[model samples]
Target chain A: MLKIEGLRVELPGFALQDIHLEIANGDYFVLVGPSASGKTVLLETIAGMHRVSTGHIWLDQRDITGLEPERRQLGMVYQDCALFPHLSVAENIAFGLKVRGRPPSDIARQQERLVRLLDIGPLLARRTTRLSGGERQKVALARALMTDPEVLLLDEPLGALDPQTRENVREEIIKLHTELGLTIIHVTHDFEEAVAMGQNIAVIGAGAIRQVGPADEIFRHPDSEFVARFTMAVNVFPGRTEVGPAGTSTFVVADARLLTRSTVEGPCWAAIRPDSIQLVATSSEAGPDNRFTGQISRIINKGSVVEVTVDLPPAMTCLLTRHGFDQLDLAVGRPVCLVVPPAAVHLFQD
Target chain B: MSKHPGSQLRGKSRGGGQSLNWVFTLLGMLILLFILVPLFKMVFLSNKQALGQALLDPQTLSSIGLTIYAALIATAIGFVLGVPLAYLFARREFPGKGILEGLIDLPIVVPHSAAGIALLFVFGSNFLVGRGFKAVGIQFIDSLAGIVIAMLFVSVPILITSAKESFRKVDVRLEKVARTLGASPWQAFARVTFPLAWRSILAGSLMMWARGMSEFGAVIILAYHPTVAPILVYQRFETYGLAQAIPVAAIMIMISALVFIGVQTLLRRRDAGA
Candidate 1:
């Protein structure tokens, strides 16, 4: 297991607040945040690149916060791959062993294994500059893995590739992680990438982690307003919550009332994921549940999903599949009923 | 109907820009002629008898040899000491960094005679550094040591500036990757950074050596006995007439042209191959 406690790093005009995280052995954890949210800084710090102000990092029960990057035994792959241009692919892959003074036989053995594993046998003699993006990424991965580090840190490894190459390299990295069972910490800013690759996700905002859980939990039940907005839970309303006589609660905004399962009171923010809300015809909207009658203010086609904006005194956005959108024959200025389940309305204090 | 303002301006610029290209070419050709005419005349005007005599004279040949040798030594010393300092300037920021960088360019702007006097203050026989060296039976005044000191003082800035630019061109992330791959700091530099930047460093060294070989005022100030090629040409012009000086000047010109062409061809071929 790798653990970080009270991690704080200060840079000019930016600082990472006290951060604590734990990754179990052989687990795939993804740190997701927007640009300059301190994701790369935290990864570099864990790799022993930056100086820690007040922190303790333990890897497999050994204190390694003060160790050098080479002594820390962590593999790192950057977005650009950063393959040494001076060395050919074969020499680049063997650099770690060569620097360590390992025997030629041992170096050749490991080199052959990685070459076969990554299917880069033909590229061994080629220069790094001649390889394509996917080829370069694979070679960088093989080079990092040659050292057999205890943990692998990938800093947006697929951020620089084209769409098709990104997909191919993404699968290649997943295969490597599964085959080797290496503890991996991947950092990225793409939401779909985080959901697709990470077994556990951590959402960071403004240099502090806002939420950490399974992908579904973070998507459906964000713990803070920042997490909700970052995760694209678009229908968040600032309101005051009043506990009802029963177990449910009523969140009152300017002119709309939202029923939520949360029992918390006082001023708070209520988030309802766009995908969780359903659109029904206004004529049959007779149910007494959480339903609001509103006019469709805008219809935006976002490729696979359609974003429908409605004004129920307060404008709300809802997401629907293309099939559902086509079936509903929805259009701008049309009246519709929005059904938001009480369980879907997550409330959190400021 | 009036034309759109943006389209009218674009049309005017397009026509004017093409005519301006011809004017630029004319001005550029004038400067090229100004530089090449004198050099070409000097090389082509020398008679065969004087040229043969200049090559046969031991004094002229030895001065050329000594100039080349001292420049080589000074360039070697600069490479050993200046590369690390260049890397530091390229990669790190500390107190007085801006001033240090400005100071590296000092030798370039200062007059060669003034620079010679400044070196005399610090490295003269009575100064601290010169006295310490004299204790080891080494002297700088009117000797090969003094020639090398003058050459190095005037030429090292070229080397450091070029090397620093080369280091800046190399991505620092490459070294970071090497460190994560189990290489120490020094090993990362040797295996990664040095190889990437060595081409530019060599190009810079060639320039520094060429500049040092042609230095006149500084070397004359420190050592006039073991003469360099430029000083020999001057002495020939002063004692004899311009006729005697042309042969030695032509020989130095030939050597400079050969070295310059060789370095340029080498750099071009390497770039093409890479």
Candidate 2:
């Protein structure tokens, strides 16, 4: 288990403050945030690359806050795959073992294991400069794993690859983690990647973690407006909430009222995911709690799904499958009814 | 179709660009000729009999040997002392770093005789550093030590500047990754950073050695008794005029050119292999 308590790192113009997290052994934890949002800094700090101002990092019940990176036994793969350009692939993978002065036979054994694990045998004789982006990532991963580090930190590992290559490598990395059952902390700004890879996610913004929970919980119930928006909750509105007669909640923004389950009754921001709002023709039967009739103002075909914008006083975006969009024959300037469930609107204090 | 607008414009531009290229080629050839003419003429002026006699002359041979010996020592010293400073200049920033870097390059800009005078202040027999070394029975005046100190003082900046550039080209992230992968700081530098930068460092050292070999003014002031090749060339010119000096000058030029070409060819082959 790895635990960070009250971790504070002060950089030149930014500071990550009071970071607290506990990652269980064998758990795949992800840190997700926007660019320059301290995600990489936090990962580097965990890897013992940065100086921690006020904190204690406990690994398996031992305080390792003052340990050097080598002693900390944390492997880190950089976004650019910082492979040693002068070394061939086999030498790069065996670098850690060689530096530790392992016996030749032992080193060879470990090298064989990692080469087969990463399926990089064919690339063993090639220099790192000859590898493509995806190939470089694999070599970097093999090199990082050579030391048998307790936690592997990946900083935007798939961020440099093309879309198709990224998917392939992403699957490979997931398989590597599962097969080894190693604890990993992967950092990226892609929410879909976080949801796909992480069992638990920490949403970092500015310099602090806004929320940390299971992937679905953080996605469904973000603690702040920043978390909500960063998680691609595209429909957000500043509003006030009032307790209804039956202890229900109603959020008011501009001229539209949204039914919500939140109990806090004051100025707030109501966030709704684009996929959660359902658009139906006016002739269809609609529920009463959160039904608004609006004209379709925009239509965008996004390969798999279509994004439709509805002008209901405050504009709203809804995602629909291509088949659903074709069934409705949706077009701009057509009237549509938007159905939003009360449970779908997440409201938080401003 | 006969006169497509874009094709006509492209033809005109291409014709203009070709003329500009010819002008640039002519100017480049002129400078190349200016450098090659004197060197080639000096070699051709000396007959093989005179060149063989100069090669067999004890003084000429010993002086050439001393020049190579002193330059080698100076380059070795520069590698030992300047490489660490180069690494620091490449990686770290501290107060007065700019001033220190400027001080490293000061020898290059200062007049060589003036630099000899500056060294004499600190390293002359009666001075503090000289006195300290004298306690150990090592004299700097009119000694091999003096010759090497002068050459190193003048030529080490080339080594340090190029070494600093080499170290700066290596990504610091590679070193960080090495450290994380069970290597200590020194091990990381030795295994990763040094290997990556060594080729450039070798190239820099060769340039420094060449510069040290050609150094004359500082060595003349400090150790004229133990003559290097350059001082010998000057001395022959002074006593026996240009006729006698030309043979020794031609021999030195041939040796220097041969060494330069050999090192360049070796480096090019290594680059291609890599």
Candidate 3:
């Protein structure tokens, strides 16, 4: 287990404040954030590159806050895979073991195992500078793993690869994690990657962590407006909530009424995922939930899904499957009824 | 539409193209001839027998050997001291860093005679450093150590500046990765940073060695007895005039050219292999 308590790092023009996190052993944690959000700084601090202004890092019942990077036993892979260009693939993979003064036979054994595992046997003699992006990343991973570090810190490992290569490497990382049972902390900006790989996700923005929870819960029920928007929650609005009967609340947002499960009153923010808002024709209105009629103002086709914007009192965006969109024959200026279930509307105190 | 401005310029120049080409060629040839003429004249005027005699002379041969040896020692010292300082300057930020960098290049702009005088005050037999060395039975005045120190004082800036540039080209992230891979700071520098920057460091050493070989003013002030090649040439010129001095000077030039070509070829081969 690794724990960070009250971690704060100050850099010029940026600062990470009051970061508290706990990762169980063998857990796959993903840190998701926007660009320039201090994600990399936090990762580097954890890897012992930056000194924390105030914090204590505990790893497996030991306080390692003051340990040097090499003594900390944490391996890191950068986005660019900072491999030693002067060394060939085999030498690069053997670097960590050599640095630790491991026996030559042991180093050779580990090198061979990693080469076979990563399927980089043919590249053993090739210079690191000559490897492709994917090949370089694999060698970097192999090099980092050669020392058997307790935890692996990956800083946007797939951020530098094309789509096809990214998918392949993502699977490779998952396979390695399962086979080795090593604790992994991956940082990325893509929401899909976070959901696909992260068991638990931490959303960071503006030098502070907005929320941390299971990937599904954080995506479906965000705790703040920032988290909701960052997680692709398209229909978020500032509103006033009124406590109705029996612990139910009605939110008045831009002259539209939305029923939510929360009983909080006064000013608040209400959000619903784009995929949660249902579109129906005006003539076939469903049972009364929280329904509003509006004209379809825009239809944006995004490959597998279509994004539809509704011109209600306050415009709301909804994502629909291509088949659903085709069935409804949706077009610009068509009047439609948007049905948002009360349970799907998440309320946050503003 | 009005004629394009670019076409107008081209049209204006069209009539003068032939004369412009001739003028350019003439000026280019003039600069080439200015470099080639003196070199050709020196070789042509030196008697073949005198050239052979100068090459075989024990005094001339020893002087040339001493010059190369002292320069090599100075370059070695520069490599030992300057490389770390260059890497430090490249990777760290501190107060007065800019001024310190400027000071590294100060030796190049100062007059060599003045530089020699400055060295005399600090490294002379009576000075603190010289006396300290003398207590250990080592002498700087009129010694090979004095010659090397003089050469090093005048030529070390080339090594430091070139090394700093090379270190700058190496990404700091590579060193960080090495450190995270169970390597200590010293190990990271030795394993990753030094190898990556070796080519530039070698180039800088070559330049400093060449500069030290050609150094005359400072070495003459500090140690005149050792009789490096340049001082020997000056002595020959003073005693026997241009006729005797020409052959020795030509020999020195030829030696320097050969070494320069050899180093260039080695660097080319290394680059190709890499």
> What's the TM-score of candidate 3 when only chain A is evaluated?
0.96
Q: On residues A1-350, what C-alpha lDDT tens digit does candidate 1 reach at each position?
A: 99999989988788889898989999899999999999999999999888898989999999998999889889999999999887899999999889999999999999999999999999999999899999999999999999998999999999999999999999999999999998999999997899899988999888888888887788878878888888888888889998777766898887788888887789999988888888885545525488888899999999999999988878888899999899999999999999889898898886
lDDT of 2 at B140: 82
Q: Interface Cα RMSD for candidate 1?
A: 0.7
Cα lDDT tens digits for candidate 3, A230-324: 99998888989987666668988886888888766799888888888888875555344688888899999999999999988789899999998
Across residues B128-199, which tens digit of lDDT does each residue of candidate 2 receive? 999999899987888999999999999999999989998998999999999899999999999999998887
TM match of model 3 to true structure: 0.90
Using TM-score as the measure, the top candidate is: 1
How accurate locally, in lDDT, is each candidate?
Answer: 0.90, 0.90, 0.89
Question: What tens-digit string does per-residue lDDT give for candidate 2 at A33-69?
Answer: 9999999999989888889999999999989899998
Off by over 4 Å in 2: A283-288, B1-5, B262-273
**Residue-wise lDDT of candidate 3 within B1-274, one digit each (tens)?**
4479888878779868978999999999999999878877777767999999998999999999999999999999999999999998999888999999999999899988778778988888789987888889878778999899999999999999989998998999898899889989999999999888887789789888988988888888989988999999999999999888888888877777776776687567556746
| DockQ of each two-chain model | 0.83, 0.82, 0.76
- Weakest 10 consecutive residues, lDDT, candidate 1 chain A? A281-290
Worst 10 residues of 2 chain A by lDDT: A280-289
Q: Categorize the docking of model 2.
A: high
For candidate 2, list the clashing residue pairs, or say none. Answer: none
Could you say which candidate leads in DockQ? 1
Q: Residue A203: error of model 2 in Å?
A: 1.9
